[model samples]
Target: MSALEAARRRQSWSKVTPEAPTREQLLPLVAAAGRVADHSSLQPWRLIELRGEDRIRLGEAISRVRGDDEPSTKPLRASLLIAVVASYRPSEKVPRWEQEAVASGVAHLLSLLLDEAGWGVIWRTGDYTRSPEVAALHGLGEDEALLGWLYVGGKPDRSPGSRRTVDPEPLLTALPR
Candidate 1:
């Protein structure tokens, strides 16, 4: 499928099979996302792959940070979780916000690539994403912050159903004469 078509059809799948691609298979796709636009070539981002018991550990930390939400059980929902971390770089030309934007762009592009590869994917984030305990578990550096996670697994038999879209007329604006 064409890139635009792939993007248009992209949808988040909440349910997925237990199967997932290996690091060897996924690294190439992840590498492709590196091509995302980055001002000053800062490349202010990194990804941590979580599987096996690591998910359980993350769940526990999330449980602590966000009580009564029952998010701890979420880690096990997907076969794999790719943690998106914004590794800020000191640049006079590029501010911190721009760096974070670069990281976010990478995550979005990566999600698109994962979906193209027939994987079920969803970018999950919450208030607890920046919690101290959760950051510690991911071993985030002083200049780094957790953006969120891409929960990925094999696609299920069912469709994702229709997606919600907004009209472009309300969002577009022209300069006043």
Candidate 2:
């Protein structure tokens, strides 16, 4: 599919099947996604593959942070979850914000690629993202920040509907002469 069509078809799938692409299957797509524009070629990001018991572990941590007696079912919504992390690297040329944006671009682009490859996906985040338990679960470093988790699984029988278009009239404008 053309990039335009791919972008148009890519929408968050809140619910998905119990099947997801394996790490071996996702490597190529992740490689392609990593090609996003980075100011100084500083790939200040990494992905953690969480499946099966890993999700359950994360769910437990989330539950604990939320003060819930029961484990959270949020992490179990998908068969696979890719933890998106922004690893901040000090650079004189590229600012921290730009690095973060680069990391975000990788996530968005990967979502598009995953959708094109016939997988259902949604980027999920919560107030507990920065919580101590959650951070410890990912083994995050002091310079790394939890961006979110990309919940992935097989698409349901029904096709995904196109997303609504955003009006650009107010959002885009040319510089004044």
Candidate 3:
């Protein structure tokens, strides 16, 4: 499919399942995603692939942080998940923000690819993204940021519906000429 077609299809995806992709399939998708534009040769992104019982471990961590004695059905919904982490090791040439942009690009590409391949994905982030205990669990220091968690799975027994459109006005920024 054309890039335009892919982008159009991607805009409508929601309701991801718990059916995670195999490691073999996941590795290539991630590689393709990382090939996006980086200001320099500095590869500043890392994906923590979680599957099976490991996903359960993360859900526990999230629940612990949220102080929810009950584990939410949300975590168990995915057969696997990829924690798209932004490891911004500051360098004189590449600013910290640029490294983060590169990371975001990687995550975006990864999500688009997954959605195009007929998999369901939701990029989710909340207060947990900055939780110190959560950061340490992922081997991330205070300087780094948790971009999001890509919850992935096969499209469930149902077909996904139509796309949701956003108003261009709020999304657009008019620069003063």
Residues 66-163, model 1: lDDT tens digits? 67555478999898999999999999999999999999999999989999889999899999999999999999989999999999999998997789
Of the candidates numbered 2 and 3, which has the greater TM-score value?
2
Q: Using lDDT, give the best candidate's number.
A: 2
Clashing pairs in 2: none
> Candidates sorted by lDDT, descending order?
2, 1, 3
**Candidate 3 total steric clashes:** 3
lDDT of each: 0.91, 0.93, 0.78
Candidate 2 local lDDT, 21-91, one digit each (tens): 98899999999999999888889999999999999999899999999999998999999999999999999
State TM-scores per candidate: 0.94, 0.96, 0.86
Which consecutive 10 residues in model 1 have the weakest lDDT in total?
Answer: 64-73
lDDT comparing candidate 3 with the true structure = 0.78
Q: For candidate 2, which ten residues in a row score worst on lDDT?
A: 158-167
Which candidate gets the maximum TM-score versus the true structure? 2
Better of 1 and 3 by lDDT: 1
Show the colliding residue pairs in model 3.
Answer: 18-77, 18-78, 18-79
What is the lDDT, from 0 to 100, of the residue 93 in candidate 2?
A: 92
What lDDT score is found at residue 41 in candidate 1?
93
